[model samples]
Structures are given as C-alpha cells and as structure tokens.
Target: MSAVTAPQADRAAPARTASDDLDVVPLRHWGRWVAALLVGLVAASFLLSLARNPNLDWTTVGTYLTKDFVIRGVGITLLLTALAMVIGTVGGVLVAVMRLSANPVLSWSAWLFVWFFRGTPLLVQIIFWGFLAALYERIQIGVPFTGWHLVDLDTNAVVTPIVAAVLALGLNEMAYAAEIVRGGILSVEDGQDDAATALGLTRAQTMRTIVLPQAMRVIVPPMGNETITMLKSTALVSVIGGRDLLTAVQSVYAQNFKVIPLLVVAAMWYLALTSVLSLGQYFLERRFGRGRRGSAGPGVISRWFKVSAAEGVAR
Candidate 1:
C-alpha cells in the first residue's frame, strides 16, 4: 500500500474584538442620569401619596409591626419558605436525577411529577391538600384489616393548615426546582463526566463528586430566585387559613378598617424581605461566577442601567 499523505494542520484562530465581532454599542452616560432622575421621581411620588392619605393609621401600622401576631406570622412565613425550599431542593435533585436516568420507569415517574405539578395552579393544590380529608374521611395505614398498629392519616388530624401549606409549597416548588437542576446539570460539559468515568468513577459517584459541584455554579442563581418566589408565594397559604405575613396583615386591616395602611405594612415587609434576598442573590451569583469566563456578571451600574433611555421615554 502507498504511504498515506499527512493532513495539513489548521492554525488556531485569533480572538476577535467585541466591537468588530458584534454590532453592539454601550449607552451614553447621560442616559444613566435620566434613569436616576426617573427612579427618584417615582419614589418621591409614592411617598407623597402615602403622606397625603388622611385615613392612614400610623399608630395601627406601628402597633401591628410590633404585635406578637404579626411577628409570629412573619416567623411562620420564613419557616414555611425555608422548609419548603429544603424539601423542594431535595425532591428536585431526585427528580432531576431520575429524569436523566436510563431507567424508563424512573424517567416516566419524574416526567409525570413535573408535568402535573407545573400544570396545576399552586392555589388549587393548596386547596386540594387542605381539603384532602374531606374526600377520604380517614386514611388507614395498617395492612388491610390486620391492624399492625400502622399510622392513621385522619384529615382533621393530618391536614392542618400548616401541614397543608408545607405540602403545597414543597410540591409546587419541586417542579420548578427540578427544571432548574436539570438545566444546571445539562450546562456541564460532557467531557467532565467522561473524565470522571475514566478515573474509575461510577455514574452516580461521578455525578456526586464531579457533576453536582460544577452544576451548583449554575444552580445557585435560580435557586436564589426560587427562594425569593417561595417567600412571596407563602402568602397564598393565607387562603387556607394559614396565617402568614400577608394574612396577618389582612387580619389586622380587616379589624381596624385601615386597608391601605395595613397593606402598606405587608408591602413593606415583602419589600424588605425580597430586598435582603436580592442582595444575597447578587453576592451568591458573584461568588459562583468567580474564575468563569466572559459575561460572568454585568457591572452594578450596567445592571441598573441596562435598558435604553428611549425605550422608557413615554413611561
């Protein structure tokens, strides 16, 4: 056989300047000044409106802020968010792993879980769980009629508002969390898994040791987003008579008849809570983005001044 000719090697390409490679332009600094003015004006207008409300009960607002009921309600809200997110994150990991599993049964079950939870409204789920006992008067846990002293799932006993709230929030959050986890896992390069396998790691071991740690870099931003969402969604527990932050505000407002003021209190708490979480999310995202390549983060000013001034010219 004739000797095969060697193929010519291709040279590495040069890096392109962003301006040359893409049709993008930075905004003028004057646009930033305009945005600042607009934000200040809106805030000032809102404060002025609050000051003009003659029916506003500052005393009641302050009283409710310090009241045990409101305090306890807020505490419960935080607890529910924490518990639900923890349960949801755990469930999400399982669901995501199952979804990516080779086993058809596991994949199907996980798919069904995500489909059903994501399809239904969270409020409906909360209501269903709250009234689950109404349908099955009592859930028996014993083996048939053997009475081996198993558990009894009485609706009245087991379907308390708090229990129902946790179940609803956890299950609802699981669907979204699953997607977040799946996306994060997929974002990892295939080579990472291959490399782990080459080192004599089983698939599960590779995932636990190699994949998850890398995936977390992508997972944390969305997790923070979900945590914040769950915080607000905890308010829905109020519909089932679970007194969370919003519900406590509602109770106070209903009795005192200072609707807007009481609502303002609730809004304030939500703002404070979400703001703190938002700051935490920013820092967490920054931490996760370290050592990563381009666009890991936009500068704080850029983050604030992202939109074009003309886009909101009429707002």
Candidate 2:
C-alpha cells in the first residue's frame, strides 16, 4: 500500500454573529388592519347617524333613562333575574343530583321535570304560570288525597304577575341549569369518586367537597351564559304584564310615541348590564382556571397582544 493521505479537510468555518441568534420578526397580518378599519368606519358612521338623526330623539332616551318608573323597572328586572337564578340554581343542583342518583324514581322524576320544562317554550311557560289561577282556583298544602289541609290559599292571590314571572323564569331556568350541572358532573372521572370513597367520604360530602369544586371549572362559564340569557329573557315577562325594563319602556313609548328612543334606552341598559355580567364571568373563569396549564392570565385582549408580539419576534 502506498503511503497516501487525503488532503486535509477545510478547517475554517463561517464566523458567528449575534444576528444568527436573533429572532426574525413576522409580518403583521393585513386582514387585521383591514377589519379594524372597516369596524371603526361602521361604528363612526352609526354614531354620526345617531347624533344627526332627529327621529332618534336622543333627548327622550336620556330623559326616560333615569325616570323613576324606568329605574323601578330596572330594579324589578334585576330582582327577578337574581331571584330566578338563585331558585333555578338551587333547584337545578338538586335535580342534577337526582338525575345522577341510583334510584330510578328520583332520576325519572328529575328527568320528567327537565323534559317538560325544556321541551316547552319559555314564553308559553310564563303565560301558563300567569294564568295558573284559572287552572287551579286554590292551592292547599296537606297530605295528598287526605282532604285535610294545613294551608289553603287562593291561587289568584298567590300567583301575582311578578310571582308568576319568577316561578316561570326559575322553573324554566332549572331545566337548563340541570343539564349544565349534569354535564359538569359527568366531566369528572369515575376514579375521582372511587378515590373519594376510599377516603371514607359520604356521597354528599364527596360531591360538595371534592366533585363540585372541580366541576365548577366546567359549570361556571355556562352558568354565566345562562344568567345573561335569563336577563334578556326577562323581557318576555312583558307578555304576562310583568313590569320589567321592557315593560317600562313600552309604557313610556305607548304615550309619547317615541318608540325608537325608548327602545334605544332599553337596549343601552341591557348592553350595560350584560357587559357587567361578562366582566364578572371573566373573573370567575379566571379564578376557577387557576393551577391549570395555560389557564391563569389576564383577558384574551392582553394575551393576544403578547402572543402577536412573540410571533412577530420569532418570525
């Protein structure tokens, strides 16, 4: 073998530079700017129209916005929403628990309640409750079929329009809430129940202490949505002569004939209320989302900006 050596490989390498390690900024999306511009233009046009259009009667809207009757109506609307939600949530939790129970009777009863309420239109339910007096002249609290009454009350007196509204809203809400709760419960793993059993926790204790806390992560968002829906649905109470916000506005517009302005007033109040509720829902979701990965943070707006910046740098 001849003593032959391959030529030495090139030892020199390209010089390192800070630029090599630096991130390349991504191009901003053109669509986002376009969309923003379009939205701004539309919003500005709408505002300009509202300012210049005499038919809108912004003065009437402002005048009625803080009127005593309007304020009272708003108060009543909020009261109905709050009370109905409370009643619905409490009843729904019970129904949800029953639905998850081993007892067939309890489960079936819960199911029937849900089926009837959920199947029917809420407007019809409200109407039915309003006219419940016609169906039952009196209600008696006593042993069934015993004819011995502990309390006998006139249905007409008991089921006032407001009471009827509350009952209708609450009962109807219960059906929806039950489903939300049930879904949350089912989201929990079976092993968790077993673990709770091993820990010697009773079913009730397990549900309250272990299951519900975890389920709340799933439950809260939908519950908040339901609350907002319920708030809007309160307007339907006007059909039954319930004096809610819509009714208040209707009462005003009926006389002054400033229907558009009064409606604008109601719309503004509804928007304001829903905005507050949306903020509350955001905080609640954030609170419950703690300890979960990618869950804890400020709102999507701030996070979106952060993510966009990071993407820009990385590109």
Candidate 3:
C-alpha cells in the first residue's frame, strides 16, 4: 500500500523542466507614461503659443534673414571666429608647454599672461584695443633705446577696428584655452610620460606622438564648447564697430525701426550657424573617441544605413 501510494504521488507531481522554472512576468512602468504625456502637453502648448503670436513679425524676419549686408556680416563673423580660434589655440598650446617647463622665466611669464588676461573683463580689453592709438602714437621695432629703427608702424593706421577686434578676442581666448590645454595634459597618466621616456623618445616626440593624442580625448569636448562660445562672443565685436551679425541687424533696425524683427532675424541666423557647428562637433568627438571603452555606438552614417536596411527588410 505504501509503494502504490508513493508511485501515485510521483506520477501526480511531474519533474520540472527549464521552461517551467522560468518566470515570465512583464515589467510595468506607469510613471514613464505619465512623464511622457506631461512633456508632450507642454510642448504642444509652446507650439500653439508660437503659432498664435502676432508680434513676432515673421515677414520682416524673413525679409532681412538673407539680406546682402547681413550675409556679409555673417561672413565677417565666421572669418573672425576662425582666425581668433586658430591664433588662440596655437598660443595656448605654447603657453601650456611654457607653464609646464622647468625654466622659471618661462613659467612665470606664462602665469602672468594667464592671470592678467583672465582677471580682466573681455569688454574692457576690446575697448582698450579700440582706443590703443590714444595710448601709443607709434610702434617702432628696433634695438631698445637705440636710434636705429628696423620698422615703424603708425598706431592709427595699423590697428583698425577689425584688427583690434581680432587681437582682443584672440588674446583673451588664449588665456582660457591655455587652462583647458593644461588641464587636458595633466589628466594624462604620469606613467605614459615615463613609458615614453623609457622607450628613448625625446620630450617633443613623446608629447607630439603619445601625450597629445591621448589628451585630445579629454580636450575635444571643452574645445567644442569654446568654439560655440566664441561664435556668440563675436557679437561683442559690435561694441568696437567691427560689423558682426548683431551689428548688421542693429544697423538695419536703426533705419527702419523694426527692432524686434531685425533682432529675431539675427537670432535665427545665429541658431542656424550654431546648429551646423554643433553637428560638426558631434562628428569630431566621435572620430577622436574611436577604440575607447564604452564609446562604441552607431555613428551618424551607421544609424542612417541601419534605418535604410530596416526599411528594405520590411519591404
């Protein structure tokens, strides 16, 4: 009777399989749905407001957006931004190297430059540069205190508004770029330098080949941010009569009294320029981030192709 009862119990309770052991409960995220709905509502309200607004002066904005003077101003702004960034980045790299050098004079000089420029306001620098002729009538290049002169420059003729704008923007940008470079260099492991030294590489070679390449991973993001900031900062040149985008808009508004519309046109152009720059920065960051851990992902081209393939597969 015991044997018969045991056999019956075994038959009633079957052996568990892998599928039977698995738990298949779906997760519920009700809060996510609530948050998404709230965001959608807010976005809809903002769009409705923009659509219904009458004071935006869309017609005037469209008229001046591509005006000849505005286009020229944009070209000047791009040129200034490019030249300043190039000069600033080059000078900053040199200063960063000097700051890290063993020589006392080089280090002290670099520090003083950084201190003076960073401590002072950029607007003041621009104003000072604009009025530089008042401070010095002539710039002579020759032996100090000697009558012999190799070159002489008339201050008023040489330092025009555009030149002054570039000088002020580039010099001020150099101070900030130096700090960013120094921070990036310091972020590299000490062992990397030591390893390069162990391999019999010169200081310049090591820095050029190993240290800077690695430092770029840390440097690119902040530099991208600086580039964007520099774009906006170009507006400051308007104070010096440099005729940037904002200045052109102001000039238009001054004649027509369409202040809001002209301002809106300038803002739209700025947004378009910045959007292009931002996309370029994203691609640049991706390029430098190759082979780094956790940096693996579908790039712009890859994502586009992936979507295309999915569509083809569905068809």
**Candidate with best TM-score:** 3
Q: Which regions of candidate 1 fall more than 4 Å away from where they truly are?
A: 1-39, 144-149, 295-315
Clashes of each: 0, 1, 0
**CA error at residue 69 for candidate 1, angstroms:** 0.8
Model 3: residues with Cα > 4 Å off, grouped in runs? 1-28
Candidate with the larger lDDT of 1 and 3: 3
What digit string (tens of lDDT, one per residue) describes model 1 on residues 35-136? 999999999999898787777767767777667887888899999999999999999999999999999999999999999999999999999998888898
User: How far out, in Å, is residue 308 in model 3?
Assistant: 4.0
Report clash pairs, candidate 3.
Answer: none
Tens-place lDDT digits, model 3, residues 91-175: 9989998999999999999999999999999889999999999999998789888788898999989999899999999999999
Error of 3 at 82 (Å): 0.3
Model 1 TM-score relative to the real fold: 0.81
